[model samples]
Target: MRELSVGEAARRAGVAVSALHFYERKGLIQSLRTSGNQRRYASDVLRRIAVIRVAQRVGIPLEAVRRAFSTLPDERTPSREEWAKMSAAWQDELEDRINQLMNLKEKLTECIGCGCLSLTACALANPGDALAADGGGPRRWTPG
Candidate 1:
């Protein structure tokens, strides 16, 4: 039942203190307050931080990561089974993404031989024509 001070956790987690604070606010991690109102976290938080970093590297959005973690217990440390389940789900997603990328690569290779590399005709190079009617691209939701 060891606990780490904020500085120690950030140093060990290889993340900035502010980032750690943001994670806590995002419900990705939790902490306890000391008498002086400073933050302290259980050693198990190191594992949570690692998972968050890996999830981000895999292109999983923060909101999705938060939702995935919601299925896990917060009070107790996660067991290997718990991690395995999450990893299994993520693996499926990665496989699907790989398939999509491979399909796109095949299409582009075919286009190369078809002399359709021109931006006006190339779906791979300029998707703007198809995407222009899709509400002007992805929306960036910012809090007002």
Candidate 2:
């Protein structure tokens, strides 16, 4: 079983060495240590990195990626069925995010014409001063 050094893995994964370290710390990827304490990763890590990159590109958080990766067996790369199942689980969440972004775009377009940055006047955002009840911090624009 051949393994790649951290630098080689970073090059092949198209990520910085620090990013790989971060992923390791977050448990999204794993590596083995040599007798001299150098990090070496199995070639399967390239596939894992690719999956992580795709999930991140779609705005999935590292925590979510970690959770999804946890579903795979520790000793092997995810099989096609595992990948499909994970993707299916994320589909609804991604769709919800898309809808939220679309709604935000529409509101921003309306705000441009309305000029209602003033919370008191921005009925679209402030909406009957409901946020005032929440205290001093900025209110979240998106509902959970």
Candidate 3:
């Protein structure tokens, strides 16, 4: 079987050598050593690296990626079926996060109708638009 040198793998992977070393250290990817004790990788490594990059882009944690990889046989590049299963799992997580973000955005908008304290609608603090509540005018701070 043909193998790629570490440099070749990194170049094809579009990551730095240090990143490859880091991935190896984190068990996200693997490499074999030559007789002279140099790192080499199988062609499948490019696919694995692509998965890792996509996972990261979508905010999936490295630990999560490692766990997913561990579920695979020999931790090799996932087959198409395996990828579909994995992507479905990530899709659920992304949907949940997107919901949370949308909720936060709504809260932020509510809070800032006239500058409430971020996500907090503290009644004791500067609650939403005091002047707007009474009448359309400006409110002043006495500086306590």
Candidate 4:
């Protein structure tokens, strides 16, 4: 099977070698060593790097990403079925986050019409906006 050196892998992944090393250190990817004592990675590592970057963009920490990857079999490359399942899980999480953000937007939009009284009841409200002087920030008035 084809393998990539650390530099080659990083170049193909469009990231710096140091970043690749960091990812390996963080358990986001794995590498094997050649007889010459140099790092080598399976060519499929490109896909893993892509997944790691996408997970990070979606606000998943490296630890969480590692844990998610741990659920997959490590004997061989992940099959299409495994990829589909993982992608589905991530999609569900993204959908839930989107729903939450939309809910917040709806609440803020409501505040514009409700005389901003709900601002006191809303936890996401900007604490410094007109309520800081009165100590109505999150510290003093916990959201319900």
Candidate 5:
């Protein structure tokens, strides 16, 4: 089997070297270590990286990708049937997200129309005023 050095793999995969390291750390990909302690990747890693990139572009979380990958064998590129099953699962999740976003978009207009705090329909309702239970101050800003 053909093998690629870390730098070469990163270049061919169109990702930073650090990103490859991160993926390996996350158990999303694996590498072989040489006697000199250098990382080497199978040529098939290029295809795996492509799948990861496509999944991220479609809003699939890394954890979900990891889970799906767990269902697949690591010996070779996923077979057509394997890909079909994985894609179908991702498709279903994407459909649910699209519906949720559409519903939110519709509600956003309504929310903008009225800033009333009384209506449960208020966009920032916080459902059951849950945020208030935590504290009265500003909540932490979570970065993407």
Candidate 6:
């Protein structure tokens, strides 16, 4: 079987070599090593890289990608059925995120209308300041 060098794989994958290294480190992709300790990747890795890039573009997390890839064999590209299954799993999360963004966009006008950024009155932005009770760290807003 033919194998590609790190540069060749990166070029074919349309990503930087550093990104490939990072993916390998993150367990999203794998590579073999030559006797000279040079990285070599199977042709199938190109397809895997394309999938990873698309997933990331659509806001899928690396952990999610890793989980999806864990179900596939390392020696081959993911089949259509595998891709469909992974995409279906991600669709729910993507829909939720879309809803959250829409909600936030709608609330943005209200927030601007009320100049006072008080948590008490700005229930749309921060309901009861519940995040404050968590501690003195950055508080993330969860979509209701």
TM-score of each: 0.75, 0.68, 0.69, 0.75, 0.67, 0.67
| Reference-based lDDT, each prediction | 0.79, 0.76, 0.72, 0.75, 0.75, 0.75
Badly placed stretches (over 4 Å) of model 1 are 118-144
lDDT of 5 by residue, 32-68 (tens): 8999999989876786788889778766667778877
Worst 10 residues of 1 by lDDT: 135-144
The TM-score measured for candidate 1 stands at 0.75
Q: Give the lDDT of residue 122 in candidate 6.
A: 71
lDDT of 1 by residue, 1-144 (tens): 778998999999999999999999999999989999989898878988888887777667777888888888998878889988987887876785577557667767867979887777776666555433334545531212
User: Number of the top candidate by lDDT?
Assistant: 1
Write model 3 residue lDDT over 33-120, tens digit each, in one string.
9999999888778877887887777666787788887777674556889878877876876685577557656755665665776444
For candidate 6, the C-alpha RMSD (Å) to the true structure equals: 4.8
Cα RMSD for predicted model 3: 11.3
Indicate the worst ten consecutive residues by lDDT in candidate 6.
Answer: 135-144
Cα miss at 8, model 4 (Å)? 2.4
Residue 115 CA displacement from its true place in model 4, Å: 3.6
Question: Which runs of model 3 end up more than 4 angstroms from their true locations?
Answer: 75-77, 118-144
lDDT of 4 by residue, 81-133 (tens): 99889888888767855775576677667777667665556534655443343
Candidate 3's TM-score reads 0.69
Colliding pairs, model 2? none
Backbone Cα, N, C clashes tallied per candidate: 0, 0, 0, 0, 0, 0
Candidate 3 pairs with clashing backbones: none
